[model samples]
Target: MQLPATQAQLSPVAGDASNRRYFRLQLPLRTVIVVDAPPATEKNREFLAVDALLAQSGVRVPEVLAADQERGYLLLEDLGDALLLSRLNGINVDHYYGQALAILRQLAAADTAAVALPEYAAQLLAEELARFPQWFLQRLLGLDLDAGEQAMLAGLDAALIGSALAQPRVLVHRDFHSRNLMCLANDSLAVIDFQDAVLGPVTYDPVSLLRDCYIRWPRARVEQWALGHRDSLHAAGLLPAVDDSTFLHWFDWMGLQRHLKVLGTFARLSLRDGKTAYLADLPLVLEHILEVLQVYAGQDVQLDAFHDWFRQRLQPAIADQSWSGR
Candidate 1:
C-alpha cells in the first residue's frame, strides 16, 4: 500500500555513486529511508540479496521494512546519526575502526555455500585493468601505449593476476570504506552501499578500508590496523595458517588492482555521471597505484612502465585540477 501523504514527508537524504536518490522520510509513527532507484541502471535484486546476506551474517545493515522492486522503492530501518566519516572529525579513529573491523570479520565469515557470489577471476581483473588503456590512456590522457610497452604490460598484468588469484578467496564487501559505515545508537555500526558484495580475495576489503580514496590513513597506522584484522580473522577461524608478512603481500597486491580500477572508476564517475566531486580524489588514487607498484618492483617490470605513464599523464591533471580547484 502507498504510504499516506499525510503520514510522511520525504526529503533528500544524499546522492550516491550510482543514479539512485535516497530520501529521509518522516512518518507519523517512525522515520525511514526510501531508496529511489530508477529503472534504467540499477536493479533491485542485488540490494535484496545483499541485505539478506549481511543480516544472516549478523552485520548491522539497515533493516528492510518494505520493498517494491518493480517500482524501485524500499523503506529501510533508520541507522541514526553517525557515518564513520563524520565521526572521524572528533572521535577516536582507533575505536571507530575497531567496531568497523568487527563487522568486516563477520562478513568474511558468512557461509559461502548458500550464497556463492561471483569471484574476481583473472579474466575479470585483467579486463578491469585494461580500462587504463581505454579510458585513462586513450580518452583521458589522449595517448597510446607503444607496441613493446603494450606487450610488456600484458605480461606484467598476467603475473599480478597470478598473485591475486593465489590469495584465499572469501566474501568481500567490495566497497567497505569509512563512508559506507554509519555509527548508530549504542555504539553499533551499520553498513550501507553493500549491493556489490561478491566472493573475492580476503585482502580486497582491507585495501578498500585502508587505502580509501575519500579519506586516507597514514601508512603505518593502516598497516597496524590491517595486521590487527588479520589476527582477528585468524582467531575467528576464517583464515588458514597465514603469517602477517604473507597477508600483507595479499593486501598490497589487491590494493594495486583496486587502485587501478578506482582510477578509471572515479574518472568515469566524474566525466560520465556529471558528478565532479570524485575528481578531487583521483590524485590520491593514482598515488596509491604508484606506491604499490614500488612494493612490487622486483616481481613486475610492466607495473613500472604503468607507474611511469600514470605519472606523466595524471600528474598533469592533478596539478591542473588543483590550480583550478575543480
Candidate 2:
C-alpha cells in the first residue's frame, strides 16, 4: 500500500492492449514504473504471480517494488522504454532477436508445477479459434459461414487443438512478441504483459516471436532462426531429440492457431473497444495466416478446404487494405 515516496515526478507512457495504464516515476536516485490496473478487470495478482515465476526461472521481469492489491496499483522496477521492436533492423535484428529468443527459451522451460495457472488446452485453444469467426467474420465483416465452410472450420479446429495439446507442455507467454519485450540497458530482453501466461505448447512462444503480427521477416530467415532455437533447446536439454522437419511443423501450426485468435481479437478491439489502431495490423496477421496455409494445407484436407475458403472469401476483404496485396 506504500508508494516509493510521498510524491515523485510522473509522466504517462504509451499504452498497450490491456486496460492497465502505466506511468514512469522520475525519482532522485532511481526511476520506476507504476501500473494502474483496475481490480475489476485486470488480474494484478496473476501478474505478480507470473512475474515471480519468471524471475525465479532467470528470465528478466520487472521486479515489483510496491503493490496495493485492493487498489490494483503496482510499482515496479523500470526496465526502460527500449522495446526490442524499435531496435530491430537488418543490422541489429540478429543480436536483438538472439537476446529475446534466449529469454523466450528460459520462459518456456520455466518451472510451472508450483504455480496455479490455466492450461492452454484443447477447449481453450478452440475457443480462441472460434473468436475468428465470432468477432472477425460475423461481427466485423458481417459475413456468415456456410455449412460446408463451417464443417471445414470444425475440422481445422480439431487439427489445431490436437497439434497444440500433443506438444510438450510448458509455461507459455501467451503473447510473446517484440512489442511485449523490453530491451534493457544491458541488452537483455525483459518480458512484460505476462499475466496471461499458461501451461501450453512449447512451440507457442517461438511462433509468436518468429511470425510476429507487428513485424514481418522473410520465410527463409525465420526458418533458420527457428531451427537454431530448436538447437538451443536441445543443447539445454529442455527439448527431447526430434527431427527438424517435425519441430518446424509444430512451430508453423502453432502460428496458425495464434494468428486465427489474433484476427478475431484485433477485430473485437477495434469494433467493441474503439481501439482502431489494431485494425491497421490485421492485414499483416491475415497475410501470416495465408502464408502458413500455403505450406500446410496440402497435407490436410480440412486445412485445404479452409485455405480455399479463406482465399476465396476472406482474402478479398483484406485486399482492400493497402498493406495486403494478396
On the 0 to 100 scale, the lDDT of residue 306 in model 2 is: 85
Candidate 2, residues 212-313, lDDT tens digits: the string is 999999999999999998889889988888788888889998999999999999988888889988988988898898898898867878778888988888
Candidate 1: segments with Cα more than 4 A from true spot: 89-91, 312-326
TM-score of 2: 0.94
Q: What is the lDDT of residue 233 in candidate 2?
A: 87
Looking at model 1, report the run of 10 residues with the lowest lDDT sum: 317-326
Q: Top model by lDDT, which number? A: 2
**TM-scores, in order shown?**
0.91, 0.94
Q: All models: lDDT?
A: 0.79, 0.88
